[model samples]
Target chain A: MENIFRIIVCIKQVPGTTEIKINPETNTLVREGIETVINPFDTYAIEEGVRIKERMQQSGSEAEVTAITMGPAQSESILREAISLGADKAILLSDRAFAGADTWATALTLKNAVKKLEGWRLIILGKQTLDGDTGQVGPELAHMLNIPFIGYASSIEHISGQKITVKRLAEDRYETFEVRLPAAISVGKDINVPRVPSLRGKLKAKNETIPVLNIADLSMDEKDAGLSGSYTQVIKIFTPKHVYEVKMIEGSPDEQAEELFTKLKQLNIV
Target chain B: MEIKVDKTTCTGCSLCKNFCMYDAIEITGGKAIINDNCIFCGACIDACKFKSIEITGIHEKNFDFSAYSGVMIFIEQHEGTVAEVSYELLSEGRKLADALGSKLYGIMPGYELKEKISGIFNYGIDRLYIADNEIFKHNIDDIYSKILVQAINKYRPDIFLGGATSFGRTLLPKVAAIIKTGLTADCTALSIDPEKKILLQTRPTFGGNVLATIITRNARPQMATVRPHVMAKEPVQNAENRQTDNYLKYSDRIEFLEFDPLNFKTKYKLLSREKELGQSINLSDYDVIVSGGRGIGGPDNFSLIKELADSLGGVVGASRAAVDSNWISYPHQVGQTGKTVNPKVYIACGISGAIQHLAGMQTSDIIIAINRDPDAPIFKIANYGIVGDLFEIIPRLIKKIKNGKGIT
Candidate 1:
């Protein structure tokens, strides 16, 4: 029998941070009806995971991939899209109890869900979710799982049998680590070229029934599912105080050049 | 208050250690490390003329809750080894603990972290509240928040602290939510009020503009994430009175760790320098910059700017263009995409600065812009403007600078 690898990739849907506009009057994110998309970094993670599974199948090895997310019912679209991209399964950890969860609670719930899944060969993650840009989940998940994690991975090499070695990105140099089976690795945009899902794959994903698990279903303590279990809370979410008032850069070269230099020099920039 | 010594920029600047009346700094590996007992009086930081010393860990304090009590530091670890930031938090914790007339505790979750427990004895922790398991190793927010909530509910500490690393950032917010407590991220300051016995949580708001001080009057365990390199990590001076009251609460903590074998394959790896672990920047004080941008067109063209910069005894810079185009190293990018510089003279050969681009380097003393675009933002800020193609002006500028005829 061929050695099989199972990969779980974590993705989050967030209000496009770049597109996030604050209500000028209230100074809060304009959430009355906002456009949301899968976090940019996570797309890299998903694409990389799909790429790994394809490579495994190409090499005549067993590889199964799962795309998992924890969000509301509306968040199901991203998973369906992931399924179309060749994820073996799509799992959602969603419930009213998970609402208003902090990073800690989200991590724990995912960890518990991972435990429920039991056996897996590789856990792929994005370096950060764009919404918060905290870049904490992967390392935190690794910490909670008590496994060696290679962070900000740029390349994957030497994958065979029960062992995998990845090129971990570090300050000034890259270090290679050979981790045993069963490790969580967070990848960045530098990881790989993600493949676009084929039409057939997208069609199949449309019919797939993604599974959803709640705290009650997982036998999780209610206190641990939401705000009760979190260590940090956003006391308030307000718009930034100093808005970049979109100063247009349009003027004559000589005068504008002089004006720019004077302002920066006064601010003591250059 | 914290004073960060960018070890690389520290040119044996003992002014910090010498100026520190509390004797908080000790130079190691050719860098200054703040030892314990350093208070945030801004004395040594102000004395460091090189400005290499940055105050990060310190935040404002809110002392409104006279009924608050206890100081707690979240013990963050990687692969069973505790991170140094947690210890720094502990050092800060002791002061908060004293102000509350209570004890300092290290809150951690894991299995078999006992070997590391001995180190906290010298840090003045009154207790080690630990919940460990095979599943607890990965920092899953749900599991950890739940466990921490259990621990906090059981013990009811007043102040909670975590390092501003990835793990703490993820988990702290969860714990704060569960407990309905207010939290400040990347806190640069933390203190306690003597009169009210409450914790003060201060963090920068509006992209490091104003300092926002928050207080949790009704919530237990007021929380904050302390930036690294602010508070001094005190060397154990005396710990005769220190005690480790271990609370073994494994009853409710879940068995939640699961491991997945990872695939390690990629076309390229992030250069180690980008991660900055076990390493530091050594170019914080370079007098001149010779930066390039996507305007150079490719990595090969970087040689032009490199040669020009080399001739000027300066370094190279880039617009976010160069970094995004992958034409140069991310470290070399000059815009908001890379390091913010205030060098004596910044030369923008082909760069057209965006507003985000200018925000980072608007402080350069003399900006010389050489762009074909007369409308380029760089020209607007340039002290000396050259409205010519960089491809044309650069070679001439290089020759002129080499022949000592460029600047006037």
Candidate 2:
């Protein structure tokens, strides 16, 4: 057991399209017929996790990658998909009590689930989810677990006994940092290109049965698992309205180009 | 929380089903039943006209909030100068502090910042806390979060604000989690709730298609990170006026703090730092930007966008679609997941604007759209729209500008 290392990748299932529409009468999102897929950013995380596992195993050390997600029962599809992408095992944390969890509660639930696993050395997640678009859960989960976190990691340089070096992309510069083990990292899309599932891997994944964990399984109290544990609540949700007065420059390409240049000049733009 | 629907009141008209974005409501046997998919967003409760859908079990917890006071903002600094977003936070924080009848404070943890401390007061910060040490030089999350959590526990500010920069987004959530509080990210709007006397943080979700207003009722210090350029910076006030009104010198307002770096042991160590190469031009810093999208056809066509930008003495930007297709690098991407820019002039070439792409550059002073499709959504938000092939129109425009013949 001491020779084995475990890498956990946290993922989410998000609506596949950005063309979400609101019902004109009800003024709410039309979720019907919308396809769901693993968040695009999380794909990079899964790839990086699998790459790390392969790199370590090549050196004659034991390593495994596990994919974890918290969503509806239907979300098991993504976990299976993760298995096809090289995850050795998958876990689905789903319960009626886990509904309405904000970032805080979501992180707490993840913390509890991670604690249940043995020989875990590192955790990986996407920098942010498309649907929530809040990039807080990774750092929050790390804090809850009392470990260091590095966000927006562009590359993982090396991993050795009790230490890992990661390159992070900041607003103005790229910084390289060395962190101790039992740390969490959230990666952006630039890290790696996610690989397509191999035919053999897909067959193995189709036959794999992912274990489902609920709040009770993790020994988490009911209040601390879902909406009751959430610190922030959404007070209102509405569609944003934009108003602009546009002037159409209608003519031949030359005429339109001339008019655009003249207008930009008038505005002192170009 | 528990949600229940009164079978007697539910007409099975399925009105509530239309409002549920989660697809949790099912009209089973002429009654609306909520399944496990419900996130308890309360949207159905509002949609039900008969008040049939109700959520219970939201009990108020007993927590003492009176121990917290004042509004505190994290002043982000790199090298020796303060980040521009910090000033914007100060300006917004000042308003929030004034509205709550509380004092506005700022916290800066850096090295050799003695000379730069007083200038921040011009933005209406009452007291600035300094943790000037050599170890505070780099923006290390492990060390910074520990220092911040210590400061937060000791000072206990009612409201905490930070700019939604790369550093803030990573650091604040760590602090919030350690302190067991709620934190809202990339807030576009902040105001004090008149009735509850609490902070209401509003931000866009679902790729800017929806806006959600959030509140932390029981948390000690409600935390929020605001996006840069979304809020206006207040005009800098003269030292004479501020000193005369306060009857105190700038030095009197400074509070120097001491912390033992060894106590906050962190396994994190900075190995190296380097500037991003190749793309030296920061799109946000430029006044004029020329962007291309999927209609640019391929990566090779980005040269046209770059040529036009260079001719205009601006920079090149790209829509998410173009970046996703590898037509351009991620640094040049402008959208929800990318940089939010507010340049003086924005030129869209061959870009059928998506809502996510529009969220980043809609705030530019002037927008010019060039697309073959007359009904492109970009035209709706653009000030001047040219319905023509970008390949032709852009070359002509660039040739005219390069010829330098259309003079004043």
Candidate 3:
């Protein structure tokens, strides 16, 4: 019997448009005008957290869901969006010191932020982000916190008191794990279908104010909080040159397969 | 500190056995053996008659990055079958090693793989490191990362490569974190600088809208994972005997090292694992793949794509949209987040070819796109573009294939 089950859902705002252009000289994304939204994967995480909170409430247990994001101040919109989808509170870890951070530094910042909360039963995260597909943040954060981590969680089977059972998706198999409280999990998109915000919820979200946290607020120093703490550095970015060329087989469907089959035979791929 | 014995150079000298105070050295058969109790105190090295023992210190002050050599590939296996990406990586890794004038090595961890990887030497690997332990049968990220980190630290390969499969995606990041090195995910191309001997890793970013070439810059034993089918698997040809089958016996060029995993630890435990609920289709094996998208309308329409796939003797693939819509199974989805397929011929029906989708199948030999919208992004990459209703076009393609006029 727990008085309150506190869960933290981490979210990130990534570029929404696919028409991203690179600055040829610097080899960096031109993020000036592109629209940004919550990372697509994080939406599933947010929904899962909210769903767990609802399940706790239905069972007559006091539960609170908090959504956290580490980005610029503009990322508050996604936190507010999380609120609209049933999050009880939202916190934004925003500061110039956190810019240019790699997954390690980002995890450090998130770990410090989580420590500031004092008590939390679980932390939920998306499998990975679109901008950086490293999939290292959740595990790295767990490493920092010295807690158990389960990646690729497909479903939450049950949660009782301080223990949670989850189904994780592996290659060609599905594994189930039972982890104690204070553990972190990164959920896959198959976990649950995120629900759309209702009109009433949207109205409430419009007026919500997200609290902002800076390096000073969490007592984290600059050297251990951002790019300075990161061990690996990206030296260059360029377009991958095509290793081989492809030949087109033109004409109707009948002619297309005919040409493809002939070419396959010629290449000895058949 | 670490203690090692070079099997090739040892000459069955038992003189060093008398110097070990802990009785860690034993004369087994003819060669001198170092047991687990050896404290690496270096007394035996001073007394070694043949001078076969090597001592390496782990302190940062004595560590030399220059001592690390060779390019290593992690051969991932599933249900006793080696993944195709392992061979593909070997093919690509050989070129990188040759450019740097380094030997190429492979590390495979599983329960039993002696027979499965017998043909690995044909790929030009100089040595094969194996850990055939029951703990490796299941995909446990923490345990696998621990073993790999130990192997990497011991072998000290300059560059390590793995396939960007589900296991690698989770495992490599943890390894990189523990070893404190750089790891690039889902790389499409790899090359050596030749001048500086750096691994140039290239991969897609920004939702597959842009490609980025990243370099480790400072880390030793640079690691990278490339998607399956991104590189062609070309075995080294043997002029002495050209076998009709792909597997050629080149055992002389390869050496084996059995990795000992007695000192590894992990916190998480796998309570149970069950087979996937639905049918599992290995999309990588098919030569021709027919995939549908949201344009197919509903779950019932997937049968149409199946009919076309059956007529072509191939498998049915679906877009993330179709899979999300519950029209098809998750295993059938083909996209950046799904499966990267390099089929001989790929037919995209009603799929708008999102950048995510293109990232998976764009490497196919020939892409034939059929969509009602002529300006669909898929048309840009399709060798043959069809602007018509898929319901109308797919049926005609299936009928023609069934009549043995277009396919056979």
Across residues B1-408, which tens digit of lDDT does each residue of candidate 3 receive?
356777777876655565443356788878788865453435466556576987543222223569778999999887568888999999998998899999999988877665777667678887778777887887677778877887899989999999988778767877877887767888888888768778888776655555666676446788888888879898888624423222235455434455556665566666888876558766887998999998889999999999888867789999999998889987798986677788988989899987688877877887878787876778766776667777866776566556654445
Segments in model 2 whose C-alpha atoms lie over 4 Å from true places? A22-32, B6-19, B28-31, B45-52, B236-249, B280-282, B359-365, B399-408
- Please give me the total number of clashing residue pairs in predicted model 2: 0
Candidate 3 runs further than 4 Å off: A1-3, A18-33, A198-204, A218-221, A239-270, B1-64, B239-262, B277-282, B294-299, B320-331, B336-339, B405-408
lDDT of 1 by residue, A205-238 (tens): 8888888998877788876665555544333222
The candidate that wins on DockQ is 2
Model 1, B1-408: lDDT tens digits are: 234677666787576664443345688877888753333335455556676876552223344444445776778775477787888888888877777678787677776675666566678777777666655655444556666776677667778888876456656755665565656566767777567555666654322212345455435667778866556788456664323333233212212223221321222222222334432232224556766765667888889988876765667777777777777665576643245566777777777766445645655656667677777766655666667556765675455445443343
Pairwise lDDT winner, candidates 1 and 3: 3
Judged by whole-model lDDT over C-alpha atoms, candidate 3 comes out at 0.76
TM-score of each: 0.57, 0.93, 0.80
Residue B266 shift from truth in candidate 2, angstroms:
1.6
Judged by lDDT against the true structure, how good is candidate 1?
Answer: 0.63
| Model 1 docking category | incorrect
State residue A123's C-alpha deviation in candidate 2, in Å: 0.3
Chain A TM-score of model 1 comes to 0.88
Q: Candidate 1 or 2, higher TM-score?
A: 2
Instruction: State the weakest 10-residue window (summed lDDT) of model 2 chain A.
Output: A19-28
Better of 2 and 3 by DockQ: 2
What are the DockQ scores of the candidates, in order?
0.04, 0.66, 0.18
